[model samples]
Target: MASERIDLLIIGAGPAGMSAAVEARRHGLEVLVLDEQPSPGGQIYRNIRESDPQRLAILGDDYSAGRRLADEFIASGARYVPGAAVWQVGEQCQVHYLLEGRSVVVQARRLLIATGAFERPMPIPGWTLPGVMSAGAGQILLKSAALLPAGPVVLAGCGPLLYLLAVQYLKAGIQLSALVDTAEHRDILQAWRHIPKALLGWRDLLKGLSLLAKLRLAKLPHYRGARALRIEGAECAEAFCFSSGGKVHRLPTNLVLLHQGVVPNTQISWSLRMRHQWSDAQLCWRADRDQWGETSLAGVFIAGDGGAIGGALAAREQGRLVALAVASQLQRLDGARRDHLAREPQGALARCLAARPLIDALYRPQAENRIPHNEVIVCRCEEVTAGQVRADVRFGCLGPSQAKTFNRCGMGPCQGRLCGLSVTEVIAEQRQVSPSVVGYYRVRPPLKPITLAQLASQSNHDLSPETP
Candidate 1:
């Protein structure tokens, strides 16, 4: 079959994608949105439509705000296809996705990638253990299934999300064992310079402070400046061990939720061979995108956390900005009209992102956590340890792609999503060079796994001769 064609195609239904879809529809653009989730809200607002009143109360207003965006998106008349896993994107704006066990293709004049961020890997010892998972996963369980850990849970690591989840769990009456904060005092000190500007986004700063206040009210054990984290267990995670304030502490817990912060999900961008730069502030690779979210590649755009580590509000504004840019590019709106339309969202985006410097500085992952111990498992899919990566680097393996040949690190089922940052940092540390110099994995196409049958089923007309 000939590929379904549209004026604009958006991947992901998060705040960015949803907002972009709504704005594009207003400009009389034929927009189609494809998402991997079963629901409209991305991870931030997952299941917002189906969430009960009590659950909404527990999750708080920031999450509930997504409902308005979702409703707007639905009412905007954009075609939305959920549960569509886009595996490959071509340079010509052709997208191949798997839906209901069939591979389908679509081509668009313009494409928007709003697939948001993922938590940075905290590759401490025994991180791959059964009972240890990211704090984001725990939030997902609570959001989607209304499930919490059965026994004592220890939320370890540093970030605003760590305390936010703790407060949410407290509201749900799930008592946490302790919070092992990996952030150092120096982090706050480093962030002090950004405080004046961060105040422009005072509501966020207040929300963070409020979350901490609630945790204090509950009298939860908050271990500050924690370091040298290790999960101890023979089979599953039994205890979390860490050092703080010149003393070692071991907390017996069945569940350990780890998080430092989130980084842009640049898998698709990298796979497309788009230019990327290592962000020293956020400590991750960010795709090079213009003010309106268009990337190094023409006709393709990135919005939300997929382009950078902006929060939900910033992402929503970014989506609107990209929509304006796309509308202008398609001549649906003149450049002057588009600029006039974009003014509000541009201001909003600035306001939303004003506090990021403070947040990034305050929660920067320590070198020890970023560059794990030699024995720690960095690549969980291939069971590649940091020691192996370092040994390979010492043997003259230059970068992540070279390390991939030395050992099957990024050649895993997840395609370096889980291990890319860790490997880059490890090689950079070993070589005494910057992460930008060491570089990230050379991401190729077939971004996600697809069956041979799925490929065979696609019509000849849908296949592209040119590789992305």
Candidate 2:
């Protein structure tokens, strides 16, 4: 197996990792970044193909800036490896990973995980149909490939993303059948306390408000109290049925772009045995980090959504902060210099988080199943149906881990990476506890895969005089 060492090993190539690498290299640290995709951009604001840069301006500048940083990371002498799926990570200062179908070990003085997040799914009857997808997934296809699904699309669910997609559809010149969600007056009321935090930064607040204004102008079919109960179709999605105050609503559409919200991508970090905190606002779990981005394990750091759902802006700021801390620890920078480098962006991210306090309040776990009577696939990896999960619970297994042991819902190639959020809701509903009370998940170690030779070689290093 190939083996190498670096001053820092960054386990993602998205905004957080890119940002961290750029700043760290400036302060004189050797950085290596690994990503599963062929290129650098992550799900949000991924690069779109266009003959002209002016054409890319159609989506927004988020992609433009990411492109610049990605290019810089490639040019800055920091090692960049794409098409590498990093499965296991640990606190023992070694990484077991796969590259071109072979296992390799990377020994790092320090490690930073910026492995981003995935969309949260809310299951319903026809959701298993060919057309239903997380809103983020839909946008990734459009943003990355400039492709749009056929026929009318329904943008349902909640959060800023719902409206963001509605606006994107309007810009892409696609007519939306209906934009639906269940938002009570209490949803906004619960969010009010968060406004002051968000209002601290005018630019960030203004940007979010601008997106809302665009949604208002688009004049698409939007429902506040509407809740999708089921999707009805024989082979594919033809229409969806929803309810509000005893009144049933059936929105006719061919595609359903749905997502409850986004949760932190914690699988890689969890596999390293990092402590995870359940963010009630995010309705998902994230790894814990100190102000400087250090995890519970020494030499392992985290930034971006892996630490918290601070969005792209927060993720970017955290990158700068982590870079400074890491450089200082490795002696390329100093404490005062590190603090100075982090001050401005850290304050700005905090202001941004405070400005949209309501965003977090909007994503709390669902109290009811929010699913339909028919079978809706929750764990796509295991092909586990909602009925099967309920059957397992009926047999007395509760909680996601236990439920996984019973029905094998979250155990698959993706592990629980894709369906964890949905399964959490199912577990909470069965246990009749707030999803918060159900608590977040715990990641077992050996976060990435390792080879037998690498393991044996590592253990017997001192036994062989010629090994080094």
Candidate 3:
């Protein structure tokens, strides 16, 4: 009944986790990868393995590219357990996860967290309405179920994803009512300085431009420099409203998709009480990581969007780098050998990230959108409003942890996954301080919800480590 143990335990099966597993196996390290998804690809390439040819064509090559990585990981001899919901990670490299309605524990010599990123919450008024969801959710439907919005749909917010999803939807014969862009002329101006470095990532720039060109060719109603977004409906979203060029426009639509960008999913790191720094450019908290992706704690490392907002390509390279570092640490590879093995991935990682500053600058979420109005719901789980958070700030709620006590802001089922960034920004705006000063929610486990039966099912022997 002793728990399983391995040389390395990875908690995600995204680009980073998959790539790390393949590389670790090459170095003859015993690796085990546990992912909550039923498949290997993370959000960026979700459901790639089972995707049909037509679905792959509609999703584009970038998504289809994950098939190769997933295949390699499957063949790499590393142990992969799908549908494992990891809830608690112990400081001693012990991980507790639920599988098949039962709790299981595992120990590792090293732990790699590649949980990846999620879309930043867009907390405009009526976002909690039934017909409104993040653009990422829309993409998920398309990728996983081959489903498209059936009614009049409006895509709003900034970032390359908005355009990319629009193009995909267009290719799938779904006509969007309009595309309301929240990026302003000033954002473009701010991004200009990063253009030179971004050129090093010319391929990404060209891909972005291609997506834009397709949108223009489709003659989609594209609104630029939009602000003051509001989704109006009595019980569900009916119309998307925004202001652009000093004029307010409201488009009648049954579905409203909103996105600013993605930020690292650092919930696991936060639960571990690792040091995190606020990212001004990305507008989220990032777990501190070294060049090799090791976190502030030894034997624990993070890579991909979980550590920073690098795209999939960067995440793949980071995964390899982290694996190499782990191998060297485990004495499977000497220092010189590790460095030699890391050269290609390191260069590739740099190239992938060269354009990030420009993208971050260009798609920085508007202050109004991030801070939200007093009436707008910021925490969907607890139905906490910006006004409530602001009032709590006035009543001496200094940080997200305090706000939780005052109004249950981050105490909901999501464990502050959706509302953490918004709550921190709202409190900071209310207190006239930086988000770093306001800080984030003090995260704990169970990282995901668990049932009493699951906990009871774990016998003491299963929870105990085997004696050497």
Better of 1 and 2 by lDDT: 1
- Cα lDDT tens digits, model 1, 1-468, are 334447889999999999999999998998889999999999999999999999999999999999999999988878888899999999888888988888888888899999999999899998999999999999999999999888899999989888889999999999889989988778889999999999999988998889888988999999999988999999999999999999999999879999999999998999899999999999999999989899999999999999999899999999999999999999999999999999999999998998999999998888888899899999999999999999999899999999999999989898898999999999998999999999999998788899999987774223233221
Error of 3 at 285 (Å): 0.8
The weakest ten consecutive residues by lDDT in model 3 span 459-468
Which ranges in model 2 have alpha carbons more than 4 Å from their true place?
A: 1-5, 48-51, 244-246, 363-366, 369-376, 385-395, 433-468
Give candidate 1's root-mean-square deviation (CA, Å): 3.4
Tens digit per residue, CA lDDT, model 3, 271-356: 89999999898889999989999999998999899999999999999999999999999999999999998999999999999999
**How does residue 392 of candidate 2 score in lDDT?**
80
Model 2, span 60-140: residue lDDT tens: 665566666767776767777777777567676666666666665677788888888777666666667888888888877
Q: How large an RMSD does model 2 have?
A: 4.6
Candidate-wise lDDT, in order: 0.91, 0.72, 0.91
TM-score of each: 0.97, 0.88, 0.97
Misplaced by over 4 Å in model 3 are 1-5, 459-468
Model 2 has how many clashing residue pairs?
A: 13
